[model samples]
Structure formats: structure tokens, C-alpha cells
Target: MQHRPIKTAVFPVAGQGTRFLPATKAVPKEMLPVVDKPLLQYAVDEALAAGIERLVFITARGKGAIDDHFDMASELVAGLKARGKTAELASLEGTCLEPGRITSIRQQEPAGLGHAVWCARHIVGADAFAVLLPDELLWNPARPALAAMHDAYRQMGGNIISVLEVTEAHTHRYGIVTPGRSDGLLTEVRGMVEKPQVGTAPSRLAAIGRYILQPEVMDVLAKGRRGAGGEIQLTDAMAELIGVQPFHALTFEGTRFDCGDKVGHLMANVALALERSDTGPALRDWLRSLEL
Candidate 1:
């Protein structure tokens, strides 16, 4: 039997993005544009393509602009109309969402990823909700990672997390899930260890920032203690749910960009730009001529 359809997704965007410094001083990191679109837009677009009917953002005090981005810009619309830019106007119209479709909850504290997700409990209620980390952008998949997990969730009938193989030496950077025998692309998760020591990790299949979690996780998050980095790590709560539920790790095929990091952000731009037919040749020529 297919599991319940995932109709809503939670995006955690409250953290103070200190890594980007002055750029993030006033502007939210989620608003940082990757090429032409902000990082958050890519995530929102991805979610929408994944059949997510509603979006719940866990935001803090300084995230008003994010809400505004999706709202229609009246003045811009007027100018586009005057210019007869029908295509651009239509794109903007498409971006405007019904107010009720999007909701926000205040995290109040910079607790952790777990806390951010927990804040959405009232909104998520008892349904299985997909979680998408706005900073992780995937490119050119027929569906986003969350959608892939949604498919896995439907088939597996349990909690599903997106997993990707990372360099074993860099395993500490993610929550690694130990794998058992795999049935096609989904692997049976024997256990998950967050940032395990190098060479001691059970598997290099680390959890990407995508999840299709049961509502029971909210209770676990409520009781979860502070873990790595002195924050309420979501991995801890997920770890607790492993044995209780049929947690599985899905190996999704796609190019994922870590837009959260400065270097990764640049890489996403380069990779995406090269894929655009109009810009590909020009960008290729420019890269070929660059003297390293």
C-alpha cells in the first residue's frame, strides 16, 4: 500500500548566516542570489515541482523580505505591462502565491535544526511533511530530492531520508547512515551516526538535508537533548526513530550544490551557467581562457 501523500514541506531558514558576514548582516542568506535567482527561490521552485501543495517556513525576526519575494510586486508589474514584457509578467504572476498556502513560524531561539523543525509542529500536525534545507540546491532532476524521498516514502511506508555518498575522509561533515543490503536505489538503514570519526564510519552514505518524516518525530524533537555543536541536532531525534520505524535511506541521482558554503555557492553558479544553452558556449570559452 502507498503511504500518505506528502502535501506540505517545512523549510528552516532562521539561523544567523554569519559565514557570509556583511552580506548576511542585513540581507537574509536565503535571499542571496545564485546567478539570477536567490538561493531560497531555487528551493521553493524545487518544492513546488515536487507536488508540495503547501510550504511552511521556520523563520526568525529578520526574514520579512523572504515573505515579500513571493508576494507580487505591484510597481514592477506595472512597468512590465507598459513595456509589453508578457513573458516576464507571466513569470512574476506565477511566483505570486495565495497567502494561506504559505505560513511562517518564529523559532524565537537559534537552538538548532531540530528546534527549527519542531516549531512547525502545529502546522505539520500529524502528517508526514517533507523537510528541505534551502541551502542545498539540486540541479536538473525531473524532481527534487524531496520528491524522490516522497516516492520512496510511498513505497517503503516509513520515514525516508535522502542519502549521498561523500568522501570517507569528509564523513564528519554530515549525518552518515549505515547501510544494509540495498533493494534498488533505497538502502535499509541499519543505523545512522552523525559525523563519525574517519575510518570508523559504518558507511559513507551520509544524510543529505532532505527528509520525509513522520509526525512522531515531533515528540522526539520535543524530548531530544542538545547534541553535536551544543545544538538540538535533528539527527539525534532521527536516530531515536530508526528502530521504531522502517527508516530507509534513498540514493537519489542528481547534482547537489551546497550553496550554504562560499565556495559551493560559486560552484553552483558556474555549473548552472554552463548548462544554459544560451550561456554555455560563452562561459566555456571564458573558462578555457582563464589562466590558473
Candidate 2:
């Protein structure tokens, strides 16, 4: 079951961040700062941490800012050098990726997550690929969640998706997995149901943002089979891979934040801030002083 190493990761950033509204009008939601760094940076860092070398971004119109954020800015670098703002200059290191390491594809239309992933077919070729959704941030886990998924991927070598337990009552809000035998964190994904009705879910485990999918998923998505929302749902395509292909859902090892939601975004910022030595002490004191 040897397969090409998961060297590349695809990011689907084509959806309009209507959830963020005016702020997203000019700034891509992916560009929204989680702390001082943009949300996308965290996702990129996770990919890099997990041994991902090349990044393929599926973007749409008005999302040029994503490229700009990663593009090396000569003037800014020179200014930081002249000013001797060592800390500030070093902070920019995460933002500028090496040239040619990133490939951006225009998604033309916001068909769905599956469509966005399908656009990267040629880029991914036949190798197994990783997909990280910027909206879902795995806020500073003890270790990289994707890295763990990569570990499981190398051993199991099918399709791996990171999942977390949601309350049984809240199962309708996420893509639920029909779980099979479990070995610690790894659970065999016998089946999947996207946003199932409240009482009809197969299990409490819901899919998260991290994924290691075979390239065949692109071909499945190419069928343009519309599911929920009349859009080509990635879950539906991934569901098509079960039984025939080995599918397992790995329970995430870290806390995940849905930055797509306003409260979750704020919580991520505060949580990350509270973990920083420079800000933690003061922030902790301030939080203690507050009367909730």
C-alpha cells in the first residue's frame, strides 16, 4: 500500500466570507488576523509542520490579497531593515513563502468544497493530498493534528479525515461518521452522513477541517453530483470512497476553533493570546479582574 508521500496540500478559499460581512468585503476571510498573524498563516504553518512541501490554493476573484500576503514585499523588507525592526522583520518570515511553492487556481464559481478541491486535480496528480480549511483552526495543539493524521495515513493509507466528538443533540450541524471498530484515536469510517437529521445520526463524531484524501476523490467530485445545498459536497464524494476504499476518521488531538464564526474567531485570538508569555500574564490578570 505504498503511495506517494503527501507532499502537497490544497486550500479552498473561494467562498465569499459573507459570514464576516463588511470586514470581508475588502479582506479575504482567510486573511483575517487570528492574533497578529492572518488565519491562513496558521493553516499554512500546520501544513509545513506536517511535512507538506507544496501548497495549492483554490481561490476566486477578489482574492488576490491572499497571493499578495505571501508575496515578498521589497519595500517593506527594506524599510524594516533600515529601521532595524528586527522583531517586526522576523515576524514577517511566516508570511512570505518561497517562490513557486504556492500555486493559486481561480475557482470561477463558488460551486462547493468538492468543486474547489476538484480544481486542484492536475496539481495533485496521482499522489495522496492533504486539505486544510482555513476557517477551521486547530488552535495551538500539543502537536500538529495534521502531523498525526499523516502518521496514520502512512500506516493505513486510504483516506483519513480528522474528526471530533460533538454532542449527540448537535449532530445535525456537522458531517457525522458511521463509526466502526476503534483503536485508540483511529475509528473506521463505515459510513458518513452530511448534516443528518437530529435523531438519525450514525455517530457523534463529526468531520473537521483536516483531510488526507486520495487523488481519486477529484474524479469523484468531477461527476458534479450535487448533494446538500445542490452543490457538490466534499463529504458526499468522500462518502463515495467508503467500503471500496479504506476510510478512517482520526480523533483530533487538539482544540479546534471555527474561525468562520465571529465568537469562535474571538475565542481563538484570546486563547492564543493567553498562551503567549508576552501577553498571557497581563491578559490573565485582566480576565480575572473582569466580572463575568
Per-residue lDDT over 152-220 for candidate 2, one digit per residue giving the tens place of the 0 to 100 score: 998899999999999999899888999999999999999998889889999899998889999889889
- Tens-digit lDDT track for model 1 on 26-56? 9999999887778988888888887898999
Give the TM-scores of the predictions, in the order they appear. Answer: 0.95, 0.97
For model 1, what is the C-alpha lDDT against the true structure? 0.86
List RMSD in Å for every model shown. 1.6, 1.1
Clashing pairs in 1: none
Judge candidate 1 at residue 56 and give its lDDT.
92
Candidate 2 collision pairs: none
Worst window of 10 by summed lDDT in candidate 2: 138-147
Number of clashing pairs per prediction, in order: 0, 0
* Cα misplacement distance, residue 228 of candidate 2 (Å): 0.5
Model 1 bad stretches (over 4 Å): none
